[model samples]
Target: MAKMKLRVGVIGVGAIADEKHLPNWQELEAEGRVELIGVCDIVSERAHEMAAKYGARVVHTDYKKMLADDKYDIIDVCTQNRHHAPITIASLKAGAHVIVEKPMAMNSAECRAMIQAAETNKRKLMVAQFMRFEPDSEKLKEVIDAGRLGTIYSANATYLRRRGIPGWGKFHIAKESLGGPLIDIGVHVLDLAIWLMGCPKPIAASGKVYRMFGDREDLCNAEWGEPYDRKEFDVEDYASAYVRFERDITLTMEVSWAANIENERSGVSILGDKAGISTSPLGLYGYENRSLTTTRFDWLPPQSGHRMEIRHFTECVERNRPVRVKPEESLRVQQIIDAIYESSRTNAEVPIKAT
Candidate 1:
């Protein structure tokens, strides 16, 4: 029997759709993997534009109406973080599987709601934590599994940019979108830590957010600051967190947009008793008897992210299997995020309660 093609509908034809998801799906369609069914955006012009460009037959401003009228098997939510839960729950209840853009939802409560909706509908719900599909990260996980990183102790990560802040549709620094680099770029790095630690349950967490990157709406100047305003800075441009995993593994996360750091190092390095490894540079640093040594070797591309993640989703939808980036797994990440937010608010450590 021949494989079935998933009829895919994309919500939000903005930067993420145009630059990543749609392109990958286009390639997949060219390879006979899936069919482009519909594209919807709150902005009808954007929907029409992507529809015309991607050969989608239907375009609509209201995603609910699109779901009602189209025969799409999968609904991909690429909207802002706050929109993730609503769209995903709607999609699942509409009898379609969903692929939500990362950060899952605005908070852990929303994440749990989405997870429950998926379960109730028996639909596949996935958080687009694309880093888990990266090859280098996959290899590093393997190294940890093989005990190369014996008795994993600590994990530290940094995701910093000189001044690159998002400027599209409340994505830059909207408090509703959860603000700052932490939920934006930092979510990926934090997810990397959680994934590398085998998605350990976080016990407690503490965090702080900074607003030094100016405002979040129009006024701030940079490549992506046209839609930003220095006066409306409601979210943190910098965020740091310390998470305690179940096995006593503590992960430290730092992310920033307008920091004093030189260059970007968006990676997580795990310090184990035997060795420490990191990606984005793929370095292994450890003790050799009396002397400490750091080794960097040329390895095969470890970060095949966007395309692979899209393909995996398509595969799961076609096979009727649950999504690889399980919704429950993402709930845990949201727990940490909620803890960070609560910690920042109360100026104290917050206990992480898993959903």
Candidate 2:
């Protein structure tokens, strides 16, 4: 018997779709594992361009029209943060498994709605927390799970850019992106660190967000994209937070798109009673025979996390297996994100009641 080919449809034809999702799906199609059925974007030209490149049979300016066809077996939602929930719920209700882009949605409420839709339709819904699928993350998880990082008590996640404010799309708008670097890039390291620590239930968060440098287009050290109107920048350029989790564990995180720093850097460090680990150099520190020791893995898997993430979702849908990045876990992450933003607003700690 031959394997069934998943008919895939992509809802967003933006940078993420073009860079991560489409390339992987195109490769899977070339391998005769799936079919690129259609591509949709509010911009018809972008949709048509992606469709032509990826061998998609149809192009749609509206996602609802594409969902009405009932030809897709898997729908990949790669739209902006605002559109994640609606498109995901619609896709799941349309009888297709879904893989949505990161930060889940604009808020925890939307994340819950997406989860409910997936449950009601009895379909798999996975978020694109691609960091979890990264080779280094996988190795770290293995070490932690093996009890090497005994009694994990705390973690510090930091992603800082000296002047890397994104100038594309609606990133500078709070309505579209919910928050800035915290939700945009901070979520990646935050999710990985929390996942490595076994997904502890978050209790509360206290944080501060700053909008200092994003509005200054005169800054000469941005990472990418052209200049945009400084007046349109309404989101935070930097965010710092401390989150308390169950089991007396804690996580401190810092992320920024624009900062008055010397250089850009990103990584996480987890501290345990018995052992500690840092991600950038993949180093392990512990006491061996009552002496301080350090270890490093010279052999790490050289795999593209985006490709692995897409392949994992496709295989789970094909085999009716559970997805790696569960909807509930993503909801927790969203809750933390929401609480952080709220904490920033009220200048007080916001409680996160476990679901």
Q: Candidate 2, residues 1-355: lDDT per residue as tens digits?
A: 9888999999989999999999999999999899999999999899989999888999999999999965789999998999999999999999999999997999998999999999999999999988899888999899999999789999999999988888778888889988899999998998989899999999999999998877765766445765677888889989999999999999999999988889889999999999999998788899988799999889987999999999999999888999989889989988999999999989999999979
Residue 243, candidate 2: C-alpha displacement in angstroms: 0.3
Candidate 1 local lDDT, 45-107, one digit each (tens): 889999999999888899889888976788999988878888899999988888888889888
Candidate 2 local distance difference test against the native:
0.91
TM-score of 1: 0.93
Best by TM-score: 2
Per-residue lDDT of 218 in model 2 = 70
Candidate 1 colliding pairs: 136-302, 215-230, 217-228, 217-229, 218-228, 218-229, 219-228
TM-score of each: 0.93, 0.98
Each model's lDDT comes to 0.82, 0.91
